[model samples]
Target chain A: MKLFLYLDRESVVHRLHPVTKLVALPVLFGVAMRLERLETLALLALVVVVVAALGRALDAVAGMASLLLTLLIATTLMWWLFAPQGGLLRDGFQPAALARSAGLGLRLALMVASGIVFLATTRVEDFAHGLRTLGLPYRVAFALTLAFRLVPTFVASGRAVAEAQRARGLDLDHGGLVTRMRRYTPLVVPMFLTSIRRADRLAAALETRGFGSGEKRTDLVEHRFGGRDALAAVLLVGLVAASLWGGELASQPAVQAALGSARAWLEALYAKAASRP
Target chain B: MRQRTRPGVLPGSAESLGVPRAEIARRVAECLGLVGLAGFERREPATLSGGEKQRLAIASVLAMRPSLILLDEPTTDLDPVGKGEVHAILRRLAADGLAVAVIEHETEELLDLDRILHLDAGAVRRDGPPRRLLLEVAELAAAGVEPPVAARASRWLGLAEVVREERFADEVAARGVQVERTGVRPRLATRGEAPVIEVDHLVHRYPLRDQPAVDDVSLAIRPGEFVALLGANGSGKTTLAKHLNGLLPPTSGAVRVAGHDAKKAGTAQLARHVGYVFQDPDHQIFSATVWEEMAFGPRNLGVGEDQLESRILAALEVVGLTEERDRDPFVLTKGQRQRLAVASVLATAPEILVLDEPTTGLDYNDRERMLALLADLHRRGHTVLVITHAMEVVASHCERALVMAGGKLVFDGGIPELFANDEVLARARLRAPTAWRLGRMLGLETLTPEELGAALRGGGGGNGA
Candidate 1:
């Protein structure tokens, strides 16, 4: 209920270069994208779960997983109800379709799971530093930091304004739409005015500190991409190669012939159930 | 007095009201006492004036009844009467066994405080009662807090001491530094050159306010004139200032900077002539490096790269922020950040300067430095306009003063004359300077400490001294 999931310590996952993590997450998703069999996708999901545990991001993963499960169950049920391949007899509910649904669900869940692990382990400042290292304009990087700082500030201001409004006895809870919007006028005006004023002050403060005339500037904190970055990149490349190879094998004539036979058998069973009358 | 009880109040009701523990009745009573709002029972806090609202915030906290209440520069935005009233309440709270912890930069008021906790670079530099700490003027300087009045006066007289409150009366008597009868005319500076800013029939109405913030106000400020604007909160000082540099447009009035119409010229164009330093520094700093941040305005104006560096260096020199050029603005103390804001604006090299509540949230040393910087600017012939509730700043620096109330200018005259008129100032919710107060006590009409000093040295008046 409190929704506190951003707590973690320095670990192997945390130390990996953010760019490498960014690249690796998509590669993992691509692997899931190529896999059609439910069992193989489930195995991939299991790997994600293992990685999440190793990264000490299990709590975050669990929260995402629960959300994924709810969506997956609802979507699968809806798909099954009007799936076009469904039969009238209750006894003849095809297991293959259910397997297919499981495959899709596993694929989607694993892709989301990997993303959660990556973000939970990363620090915002490191991400900004990484942007700068990757040749982003310095202004953009600093602006991102300022924007991030502004979020908490804006939230705090919002709370302060809300408290001020409540003290004034402006009841926001039981108001009409127009009244609610009107009540917000006072709060919004002050927030905007204060933010502008703050911006002005911040500008002056920054200028007075010799912010713009740097012959040379020093960074108080440093970020480095070490051995972990190399290892992670290598592993990601290997996974992509393995996934392509697996896709090639799955697309072979022999594999296709076997999958076709299984579909044919399910069709015959449905035909028999329809002919029961 | 029997403590009144509320029937079945919520567990954290006091906290919800921005006060922690006292009963609702006591909270209301405290608010009423502070604001002089009587004959109201169970009235919501939202209907109070800006000053009243601030007091209510303080009273709400008082109700929570903490043994030690931490107030962060509570009087920064308040006028004299409101500030005085709040101070009275705080004094009462202290007397009632509350260990009040106040972090403030106002030096004159420091004399009345019980204890002063001086911090420097995140470390406690000094912790003692005000009287004892006042004597360590040098040490206080190092800690970036201003010395008390007598200490400052002593410095002017070539005698400084580490004074504590118990010795205040004896030391002043012994020093033979005359406590002057107030109201004397020091040499006034000649207003030079043409008007740098001119406004005629200025009217500005914020979308929210029922009436215009600035109503048909006409004024002109010449170069090298130190002008101060005084008013109650929301009386349109800031609104009028925003129009000076084209940040805001007058609804039905004309604002011209050096004969160029501000509204017609646009903000970017007017920015070249009138450099506006915001009250807060964070809004304008959009760069990772301090060097880059300072270059923004100049870069926008298309100053040559070669010249930009020199200008920035000069600006930094003025504010004394040259050493921390690379440090993140976020990491600096509030006072330091404010100075940085000033330096950034100065880097652009505008002719006229408009500052809105520039001293708010600053510690004493920061305020003094800012005042000194303004004084230096005045000496350099830059037209400066400041909006503040602080009569001390007005007294120390300003020659001319403008008082506004209900979005109208009530009085506009010389600072001495303005403060000497009690009726006009009271109507505007502004207090006369401390010197003026002392001078009035001595039946003198002077507005500043220097004038009072002169009057006393000449043996020119009353038994009040």
Candidate 2:
């Protein structure tokens, strides 16, 4: 089974230092958090798309395309329902609520896209190497790798469990909320226990292989962070700088007016596309 | 299992490590080169073949530069090619003077070892050279270890020694045993009946793979037939089997299972007629008690409350697990857990059973029990399709064999025809089990040890008589 979104493609983004790749994640998350403007979130989404394209990981984006769209539309509509009207839907959809809800929806989608890009660009071994370099303890770094490997094991088991149950005539599709949840109950226990057992097996295998003997281990093939990695790192850092700057820029009146108009224009475009058929 | 591998050659890059980058690369290259994976440093571990992954693990341990290395069942899940690669690498390591101890159930690997330690239930039953220990077939068989084919056949032939295949022909010829190029008994299934499962030009392409997992291949299995699906890993046996139960809808062509159009039908609807048992029982067993696990399938199929108890009981009884009905499934032995998986599927009362490597990782005793259970099911008129790498199982249990390679079904015939076709066997990465080879040497078709023994005693003018 494919372990993660990590595609084994040779590309500029894929060749970046695992640590350098991971640096984008926290930075992206931070930007998404302070982001009030839908346009800024859109910028972050574009950045993710560019990175994904460079990594040859557009497939990852396309693979989860429906889910991402669903999250965007669902989160937007759902948030609009609960948006603080300062009054309710009695007044037409408030621009503030519309902006806030759309930003939230776009923000959620951007965060997931950012994650897809990071995982697609970063290899698990490189992730471990980067974590350990960042002073993540040997055992902790090893544990994280085990966790990464276990994801597929758990997924495979979960699927097998479902298929096995399905073979026994267990159908979860044709049910109400409670009925579906109840139908799913049989899957959870086995999946959980089976995953735990698999985790234990993975850990035991690592232990037997002398995972942490307190001696510094050397990699057989050392990956050199080439000039391209440095340039990619610089670009990622510049993106962070721009996001930080945007946080301060949003306080100005002119920038606020500009961001607000951009948000409204984006929402109108979305509404136009969505309302068609 | 993949945790056995490291980042490759080492755990860290050049800047973080004390060793010079050049030195580390040299070491990595040396180790990987030793294992025949010199050019695979850049390959992602996930994408490597099973045997390649095993080699990477061995190479990681090899890179550690330890004098002593140990492995437990390192080749159990690999194809014959993978197994051969691992054995070759380890033999080279042993020749280079490393103390390599391997805990393996497959007796074939022991032929290359300098010494053999025969263990029975955690106790050392015999510690001797392979030449001596391998010949003790009776004791080895009793200990639940499959004796090397040479040893078992030689013993059956009443030969005193010679436990290697190289000398098997000469040793047998000295006793006037004639070799037969073609000694296969055809056991093809009758073809008048409609197929319980049929696949026509089925193709399945995975999301990221360039090639289809199951290519445009066609086959049919008649009801009440026991069939073996044979292939190396990634050869589409599982993918093709998945189509039979509607777990995977074909990318092209059509699949018909028990008169239902698998492409159009829901998996649950098809599940009523076909039961699938996975390779690992741990993947599916979740109930606290054996009874609950057995009840799961029947309850899903909507067996009436009154008949549910009887259904569960009958399934449990069929697997000989009635005594453990109230026991926690987790506490059961691996073999028992596997049996419970079989019973769980049995509870649904599907007429067609598709088991994926049911006897893998099982000891001889458990294997025999599982085979007996399967025989019983076959006797009760259930169609069985087993996807397996075990040629011994194919030899004795299955009436017909389907061999797949590069996503294509290259051979479909009786088991004897399968063993005889070298081209299909090569493509499928299968080796004829020892019984078949021994049978060929003696000019008598044999599927099991008993069959060989009876044929030998009756045909050979033995002085022991």
Best by DockQ: 2
Q: Give the range where candidate 1 chain B is weakest over 10 consecutive residues by summed lDDT.
A: B2-11
Candidate lDDT (C-alpha), each: 0.68, 0.79
Clashes of each: 36, 6
lDDT of 2 by residue, B108-208 (tens): 76776888887777788889888677888777777777777667666666776634666665666777753434344555848799998989999999876
Q: Which candidate leads the pack in TM-score? A: 2
* Model 2, residue pairs in steric clash: A218-B10, A218-B11, A219-B10, A219-B11, A220-B9, A220-B10
Compute DockQ for each candidate against the true complex: 0.01, 0.30
